[model samples]
Target: MMPLNNSMLITGGAGFIGSYLINQLIVKGVNVICLDNFDEFYPRKSKENNIKSFIASPLFTLIEGDIRNKELLDDIFKKQTIGIVIHLAAKAGVRPSIINPQEYFDVNVNGTLNLLEVMKNHSVQNFIFASSSSIYGNNLKIPYSELDNVDFPISPYACSKKSGELLTHTYHTLYNMNVINLRFFTVYGPGQRPDLAIHKFVNNIYKNIPIEVYGDGSTSRDYTYIDDTVTGILAAIHYLEINTNVYETINLGNNYPVKLSDLIEIIEEITQKKFIEKKLPIQMGDVNITFADITKAKQLLNYHPKVSLKEGVINFKKWYEKKLV
Candidate 1:
């Protein structure tokens, strides 16, 4: 069992889901060490704002660094008594990964390798990997399961996540590390990343800008709410605490797929603004649909997603409008 006093090291803890996860854990009085590089992928100011509330909290420690920096990671592990490493750092975005496959692999795969190595050296065995449903990659299967063949990832981002999972499994096998790779679907909600479709659509509609619609708006995504995703992560941490010799790949998703056209409609209805639709050809790395089978998550973690798309979208609208002011 994990010692209660050990700090939980969460990489990318300032990003969308990472910030939310850290918030929840902080509320629960868990000691958290957040390691983030504040990448220019988005405005660093926004990410900084995400964690502003926790700046004064005694339980929170923010380390500004990259996952690829082995010396920094080694120093952190050497000093901190970290019970678990919840890895959320990665070069996100399927299209961007296609353009910069090398960078994606460097950060996602090589960076993950660096973390695992440091964890091994320090004997920090418990790990929760933030995987992606994009690994399914235009799968013919309706709802993706842990058993699905993920050997055919289409994007470098997806491939990188798959590689991380494989590396975790290798560590689990060799070092007896307890690892849980949670494949998160398209997570969205309040404080959603500016680049994500939901946030982008809402913002564009609010600003009277044309929102890009690719592939006749047929592409779909299983949008999991941020709160539900955090719940699953916490559950995984608990399971890891109580269980050993565990290596599991589970899906933490809402199990409902929303089409691109329908998603825009929802945003319009919520924000009370109609956006000009700019039609474009489907991008190279874009997938047709993503639907997750969360039976394993339910059985293992007792995870049940509580927020509906409409409710979550409404929450996001409230947050977005407040932020705009």
Candidate 2:
């Protein structure tokens, strides 16, 4: 396999997964242009700090812009010879989507459309989009697969993601673009969004605050580590390169579901602090479980998640403790 070209664009590169991917790409000697507007969902300083390690790197370029800004996108596309686009920008969160559905649609769906249009205009065909397993919304099946029926997405966020997949398919069909939509399961590790369960729990534990235990603690998630997820993303890039066929969607997850209670115990073990649990009713747009069927990813992209939840939590705790200090 030939080395990836120097020029690449990673939308939302300031966010959790995006920052990690950019760091890995830079280490591989690839020039990366990161586009992010620093949405208010998280602290701008957090996102800013996330990319500080790469700010001085000659291979890294930061563009403070939104994906919704069509003119900015057009300008970047026209100026840069971007070989691959990893679209990870989106208004991420399930319960938040319930309160602001339109906003989620605008960012996740419309913003995605703008990116696709600019890519098509610039002839940048190779693409990898950040899709979510939330698209499987309340799926009865234990482990959801790419072939599973995903027509019934409950939350607005899930609907928007599914729409993005459809839009990507349309672009691939019309322009013969090689697109891969990676339906990521619950991704967690250092730099996780504060809104996410693991991060919030870790923070609360350190602060001696009651950790909100939504639902009955029976809910489970296939928590994929950041490194493992990045590996899958890299594999998807290669997969598209090797098989320049139409569009494809694959699951990037550990395929192991751990109950909420189990996760809390792991966190407790790592932090050595007992969490004051505050039980709350299940919030809207929150699913009971998410178990990814990674068979497709394993076969197509040669993807396999390596990090276990216990190890992942320990790593996250270490990072959190350092950050607090």
Candidate 3:
């Protein structure tokens, strides 16, 4: 086994998934540089708390900056010997993207371009990009696969993610960069983004506020646990190291799809509180269901998600109670 050295950069490192990835890498004795501008989509304090555990570790370095800043990225690329670039930074909400499409494009597409340009100039080849299931749009298919057509994105955020994947493909084809675009499903568990449904529902329940149920509460999502997502990412990293000849895209998600009502009920059961249900029309940019076909990930990356929704929710509720109190 190759030893992890001073050569891993995780963009959006202060955020939920990025923070978890950073910790995992650090535990493996890898020197990791985390870069994030602390976008206003969520409270900065939350992101700060997310990475608080790594603040004192010598192997961890946090660079408070934006990926859009080409000069800053160039300086970092020159200074550090980065072996792998995990691109996870972006303005991340789908509904917000509907109101401001340009902002989404600038941050998601242009920012990714900036990173790729810097990597190209520095001759850093390895990359793992964070793509989304939103790119699948409203496909009639039950479980989305990597081979599924992703041309029709319903929201600006989805379009931006799709654009990022395309740009990654371009870089891999032209610059010979070894890349893996992981299309993450609805990831939950501890350290989830406050804007996400699970977090919002938990917070609302704690505050004794109404939990909004949208679209007759039938919308379903492949609620993947954070641990499983991290496992998939680590597998991808190992897979890329061994198979450096090609670039690939894979879906990382729980095969099970949980409905909105069922999820809420589980939360209520965990909290032992009755939620004041506020039913509303499904918001735009929201999909009816998201189910990932992880066969490709299993075959290529040996990815297998272990945590079920019930187990994940119980774990999250315990954390939420502690944090809230």
Best by TM-score: 1
Which stretches of model 1 miss by more than 4 angstroms?
Answer: none
Candidate 3 lDDT, 201-242, residue by residue in tens:
988988988987889989999999999999999998888777
TM-scores of the models, in the given order?
0.99, 0.97, 0.98
The TM-score obtained by model 2 is 0.97
Which 10 consecutive positions of candidate 2 have the poorest summed lDDT? 1-10
Candidate 2 lDDT by residue in tens digits, 125-236 = 8889999999999999879989999999989999999999999999989998889899999899999999998999999988989988988899999999999999999888
lDDT, residue 197, candidate 1: 95
lDDT string for model 1 (236-323, tens) is 9999889878999999999999999899888888877888999999999889999999999999999999999999999999998898
List the global CA lDDT of all models: 0.93, 0.91, 0.91
Predicted structure 1: lDDT: 0.93
Report lDDT (Cα) of residue 252, candidate 1: 95
**What lDDT is reached at residue 210 by model 3?**
90
Clash number by candidate, in order: 0, 0, 0
Best by lDDT: 1
